[model samples]
Target: MGSSWLPEDAEGKTLALVLGCGAAVLLLLVVVVVVWTRRRRRKPFDISLEDINNDPISVKSAPTSRTPSPKLPKRLSCPDAFQFPKQSLLVRSMTVDRVPDFTLPPERVQPRANGEKGANTTPLQYQQSLIGSLQPDLYSHSSSFSEEEDNYLPMSTYGRLWYSIVYDAAVEQLNVTLIKVKDLPGRGSHRFPRDPYVKIFLLPDDRTCRTSKVRKRTLSPIFNENFVFQVSEDDIKNRVLRFSVYDVDKRKVRHSLGHVIVPLRDVDLGHVDTYWSDLEPMTQALSSLGEIQMSLCYNPQTEKIKIGVMKARNLKHADFDQDTRFYLRVQLFYGRKIHRTKRTGSRGASVEMDMNESLSFSVAGKQMDSCRLEAALMMTAQRNGGMLTHDVEYGRVVMGPFMYARGEELIHWQEMQAQPRVPITRWHALTSNVSHD
Candidate 1:
């Protein structure tokens, strides 16, 4: 009876269409389920905020679909990030608006009896923030900086020192005194009552390592100690004084307190000078070429400045030559070939040399304004490395053209034209300043 009521040829066609639509819908549902399942299994996330979405290798490609996919939770990319997170270790001049006092994370295990180290367990963030911010600024901006803050004062427990260098023209020597080191900070890792001491050196001349006597059990030790370098006024300008402080451990290991570098050029040799220098860590490994000692003299009547290549000493040994040998080439500020020393051998394989020759340049009939003297120390020893088989640089040094000018208004030659004929002999340090003044 129902079939009769439905009554028509179109009824079969309608049922067929309905069945087709149902099959299509079912196929679509299966496809969606497969896609969603794969997506969930592919990237399940259980991570902290800092590392969340920090996928360096996972690059997102442009979606191929015309229809929008269902929206998942939006990832929290901090608004401050300009591009992808760089994870860069080096950045320039960060201005910290505030410094964070990062406390050590709660103990992973509370009992020291468990033999777990809780000291270094402090999260890296504590070492990465605040105090660490000042490190690059302190150590990097100026390698030649001698300021108290540039010395990393709060970064370590090693104390700071005040020192002075006086050049006695009469004696022809540099009287360097480690006037005092104050607030000689102690380290917790060491035993109490520290045996602290100080070591000094004139680099490229480590024939001597002048160290102060151990001041036992004193945090505030006063070492009014004096060390001497048999250097001329001209020669001292080219050297650097390296100062190091250490705690002599019971096992005889020198636990470093800190370090300080004083360029003798920075010292006012004209008078007895005192400077408060901050202590820094010995991070740079320095190699010595050698030390060059020379002197300068001005003859008014002859209108000539005479420079002598006195000697060089405490040279770094050349593996090529059983005997270290070198020579000197003197040049004026204007690139004039003034003089050259004789090709001589070291004295019986000694590192010292005695060059008795003098280099003379005529300043007569010319403006001697801002005259400078440069002496280059050259060596002829074969190299140990194959970088070069033959001769290479042993050392180089420079003295000032403007160093002794009387007046800026007058011609440099005119000022020296009528000056008293003083046979100026000063121990001048030689360095690699070959450029003309």
Candidate 2:
């Protein structure tokens, strides 16, 4: 009974296997037929020599021995479904012609009776005569001029400043005397005068600034104050004198009036000379703090960046105690935010400092392109108690590929990217107004 049952089961199994094989064959045939049909329906994209020559392209069917070749159309036409306006096929010349003369001919005046003085005047001369009659002569009535027009200054000028400079070679000192100022403009609707003051700076060293006493409620003020600057005869030749005038309001906010710059190179330092100069418009000029030497390196393998602060030169010396120190603060910025900040060890304050320190930041290789660096030279002075210190930023420099950087700052960043794993070193000028972000 067991053998009989086994035989029956085996036969049934063999029949089921045969049916499955037949079904698989039928599915394979269907896939092959579908693929063949898709390939046959695909069209071939063909370009002939005529198309390369910019001639109209024509569609043609496959040629066979039993079928004649189709005729090619000379030109192609747009379909009615979407028609484009016809355009001229001729190429327009790009050469521009000279502008036509639009000036009108000078009008001629009829000759008057004999012995007339201006009968032959042209149109231009006649217009000039009318303008001359309307406008007052500035030079003709010098005594009648108001104080505002006394200096014959431009509209941008605020007023005039009178001062004198003398170089005392024996004492190795330069003396500047502020005489007076005239014709300051009214401040508000009340037409009240300003409480004005003068700030004196010997440029190339704005760290040391001198201020004059403020005079209240006066368009004209007599300072008559003398200030002294200690400098050698050789050093004075390279210096400049800047006078910035300001007006202080009730809220203690100072408003800039104007400025005057005098280069000492043009002055005769051997004798005293008084000069009057117009207070010209104010301009944003970068103060000369100094320069710093730095090196930048990026390693794509480790995804790290290194900034080396080698040294600083021509640093403005501060008149502080012996505990004064100088250091460099390096900040890495990403997405317009500070990612990391590192500072070098402080050194004694001097004209030149040798930091020779390097700082590192961990960053991904992809992030190097979006990162920027800011190096700021800082100064700290210890108070009398020595428990706390005061920190002041001398100057800062930005290095990146963005618009915040200019000149050498942008060039240095580009060099580092070009040469991977190599350090690019350069000297960057430090400015007082560099954006930290």
Kindly provide the TM-score of model 1 when superposed on the true structure, using C-alpha atoms: 0.33
lDDT of 1 by residue, 178-294 (tens): 766767666575636678888887765644669898888776677888888787666767667878777877777566677787777777776654676667654332324545555
Scored by Cα lDDT, where does model 2 land? 0.76
In angstroms, the error of model 2 at 424 is 0.8
lDDT of each: 0.59, 0.76
Best by TM-score: 2
Q: What lDDT score goes with residue 420 in model 1?
A: 36
Q: How many pairs of residues collide in each model? A: 16, 0
lDDT of 2 by residue, 1-437 (tens): 53565677799999999999999999999999999888777723355566756733343444344476668976645344235445644433566588767988975565565676665777677667768877665423222224455457554348788788889999999888887887777797676889999989887565587899999998778898899999787778767788888888999867777778787888877656567777865433223456888998988888888898998876643544589888899898986899989999988888778889999988887776687888988888788679989887778888987445645687788788889899999888675532111
